[model samples]
Target: MSRLLALALASTLGPALSFAALSFAAPLHAQGAAAAALPKPEYLTVEQLRAKYRDPASRFMTIKGVEVHYKDEGPRGAPVLLMVHGSVSTLRTWDATTARLKTRYRIIRFDIPGYGLSGRISDEVAANVQPLDITEGLVDALGVKKLTFVGVSSGGTMGMYLAAHRPELVERLILSNTPSDPVKYDHLVMPQSFIDATARTKANNGFQDMDFWNNYLSYFAGDPKRISAKTRAEYYDFNRRVPEKYPIALVARIGDGKQATIEMAKVKAPTLLLWGNADPLLPEAAANAITRYLGSATISRVLMNDVGHYPPLEVGDRIAQLIAAYVEAGTPKL
Candidate 1:
């Protein structure tokens, strides 16, 4: 009788212990799954971006269907200098140079759609509104009958597009650090490996890939240190606030690079090509390619020593002087 009773008790206790073990392990398993599901830092909002940089001012306007943000300064009657910022960058990128040119030209700088303070396009509106359309809309909204366009990187592409599509509006064109024919320029092509790496980094970090900004700044400025801590903080803040739709829109436009290049041949404005000898992204060869396509357009190349892609910011005074001289020389016949 004692053996049988002991056996029964042992069997019941064993099952109970097994159940308890499983119950205890359930929470740990769930915790692990939760951790795996956590979003990366790259997805974090611009508000969460560090405060090591800052910009001077902000302004907004209704262009087409979106609320466009811009910085307008200097005398209204003065020659217009429309400064276009690059990809993933806001109007603030032009802060250093615009300030120096403000006394001479009416500087107009704006945040392109999906960048800076500008909001995303509504789904109700057609999904086909590209950067070129938005730029044209902005010009129309500003009532700029004629002006000089100074574009950098993506902005340079937009400027070229504008000159091609709307010849009557542009007086002088400045293309800096932007490819004229992005599709034909194999060297300027962004590698799939780079894009994949960036996507992975953003997914894992919950924020944009730091390398993108780092590479951009390094390629732009001869001295990365020239980009002030305050300015960086501001840029990070603005970047963080950027809407998710911004990246989506930008990717869509990039995919349309072929169409953009076709439009480049139609541009008839007198163009000045500015490039930094040390620029890694868009090399001097790319600048020469751009100049080749501009028929009847006067191309003035200014290769700043030690300066990277962003000569305007690294050497604002010099950039302003060159621009002033070009604009004063008279408008190019379209």
Candidate 2:
């Protein structure tokens, strides 16, 4: 893959690519030694996934016609924090951050439809919403009158739309490794090596080929060796659990996202924007676009050194602290 394509994919598709994993089948076979060492993707039953990925607090409920898999944790009546992960990421990606802040805040995270334990989008009334509308439906169903959002990448794009439209429900916002606008295929050009996992995903009915899963995930982490065994297991496990049709469906919407034209000016909630200095995906132009639209006092920008796309994975503790401070500073003291 060219450097530009990789950066664009890493920036725009950060978490979402988990929805889009290994279809690649034969490219690495030529490197016999390397190919022999890669782990094969394991296909798991829904039952198997429930056992492996389940947290005691995790629950399932039907909302708007779709089975929503979510976890609502921490003290009741405390400030609510809704975590929206980017593509390819499930609620589990926030496990580290949840643990860090659960004592002081209630955290809610769920799998977006087409990913994780979430099923297809409903065609019925209220159940048919995608992205922001889907987020509002889920939040309204949860009866959270007031809440904050921590959205990553595509999740960030979703939150931007939600906050812009539903400023009343969203109290504050934190967008990490995020995009102000939905990225298109033109920005996220994919070469063959990038989709080598496509065959793996299709062949296994949407479960990634283990070798392909590892490679695809390694891109987000920026180094394969740095990813932990537990993290690797979690990614592979969840990818296998997602229904094949959703990811396949995304193949058609490659250039699209929920964010059409970002009206950051329409957003009223206080927002924090974060990015890695090393992040290749978001060029200064794209990042500045949002900044230009929002009022200065309503938004704050922070850049991390030596980090890549996934900050919660790379510096969960720092992010947890930053969020805690941001929320505390903005919220009234009880």
Candidate 3:
């Protein structure tokens, strides 16, 4: 059956059946505002994704009291490539590149807490948890002695944190469409206008505005056409399945981006920064500020002509090639 039809049917039956069937179906639909903004997937869950994608060596690891999902490919002892996804995005964001890199390095990707299949935080905790904690905990769980770190957007932010705080764990760093200093980004700063609008929207109980979300995605893609229908459908379905409050919580956590930027100079790993020059969310100037603070780090900037915030999806092959070359040439001598 078509994915949309299946999703509609599952939704009618309620959350239990929807979760069960969707988790097993290849490219299950992801429901949410973000999903409406991105490309649709053939499947959503790890099982469904595996059935459609075909990773010969894939497994799951429990870390930080959560079931961390990952795909391990290539030789067991080959150089490892760790991919961290952006906010509100799952590992599926790297599907295209991961498929290609499986031949060279052992590539791994996972969902952070409050995202994808990973568990959510306790309701009692008012303070937001940092994604870096999940990244570090997952690294330890995977038994990875050393590896390269590739992060996109917020994922890239986490990559910066990892390289800064745990330089010993990272061999190389690749950041795409991520602002090094969050404070400067308007979205992170959450001006009065945005805060007022968000509060009003919540008060009105208008949580799922498809048009607004789609427009946001368009800005991220640099063009709406770039986001495939399949990707959008799956993303939306995933959103619908998860709690509605999560995105609000995420927005608040990102507001602390300025604090993250302060630690940029401490990131010692060789870094490559990729930006979609046209990205509305994180402009080139924001990325420039990050490059400025990366001391003693070899930095190469690639301006994707037509892409936006989600470079991995918009230009997956090009990104994979850049990462492969950077890691191969710039990996520090042991």
Candidate 4:
């Protein structure tokens, strides 16, 4: 059999076995050896990433001493939607949703400093400037008076922070697959099974391999077959380019997150828990827990079946429709 077929078969055998361990034809074994000899993935400089990925809508500005990459699109005078992407994701995560909603609302999305084309967030920058400060500064720099905040995964945590601390700036909120109380539900969110798989896969395959990302994305997806090649390639490329410090920084930042129940009580905006029921990271119980803390806000919950952690990627059009309706009606009907 061909090397491609052999590799494809190996992917089904679970994380315990490495590619080199697969017993294939002599020719395929030699090919696998050749593949293993390739150099490891290298980090891309901000300038290089920008030149390679930036589009006409791309805009750059310094927020709290960190140079930020963002896009402000759609009608200038329209109701604004401020979007924040989750870890391991860039602003482009909203591409499909933005395409559908931008015609009606002004959509603003930014790379959350440590990821994407945003400037490298060194230890010095992270120490001196908080994530919330960067977000607040970005909106202030853009001259936005009020916005509907939309966040996915950890980005949703940031949204809750803003809604609690900077309530005046947030008109509405939509959080997808977000952890309400990590301190309380850490086990449910990051199960040992997932932790073990992650450690094992990274140790064996490393970040440079396409199969690594394929497995990573697949594990997060409700339906692995639904993931597109284009999506896989984008994820693989971005992961390979991100700074070495990102993983640790993200973990530390999440660990430092505020007490959710205390913070969510301060939010006054109409909030929607738009989540995927099949999400392994934040289960339905976690999504329901958010409602308990959001006592002060008008809350709505919609859990879509067969969708995963990343709703924008898994079901963008549906997300866009819900967001548009929620923003217009001032309450979610979903």
Maximum-TM-score candidate? 4
- Segments of candidate 1 deviating more than 4 angstroms: 1-57, 125-128, 183-206, 209-216, 246-257, 330-334
Pairs with steric clashes in candidate 4: none
Worst 10 residues of 1 by lDDT: 16-25
The per-model lDDT (C-alpha) reads: 0.60, 0.63, 0.60, 0.71
Between candidates 1 and 2, the one scoring higher on lDDT is 2
Worst 10 residues of 4 by lDDT: 12-21
Residue-wise C-alpha lDDT for candidate 2, range 48-138, written one tens digit per residue:
7777667778788776566778889999889999998775677777878899999999898988766676665434523344555557777
| Ordered list by lDDT, greatest first | 4, 2, 3, 1
lDDT of 1 by residue, 1-334 (tens): 1332223222211111111111111123333543454444534343333232224555567655766767778887888889987745677777778878898888898776655666656663336556666677766777788999998766777787788778889887987777554322123333334333333333343343444345435434668877676655555456556445324343213233466556777877888877777765557777777777676566777776577766676676777777887788644544
Off by over 4 Å in 3: 1-58, 123-130, 183-206, 209-213, 244-258, 330-334
lDDT of 3 by residue, 2-102 (tens): 45333322222122110121211112222332233442322244444335543454456665454556666677788988987774577888988887788
Residue 148, model 1, lDDT: 92
Per-residue lDDT tens digits for candidate 4, residues 1-334, read: 3343333323322111111223222233433544554546565666777888899999999876778899999998999999988757789889999999988899999987766788877777767776788788888888999999999877887888898898788888999987665323123333334333333333334433576567667767878787789888877677666544533333213342356567878998889888888876567887777887788888888889898878888888999999987777757443
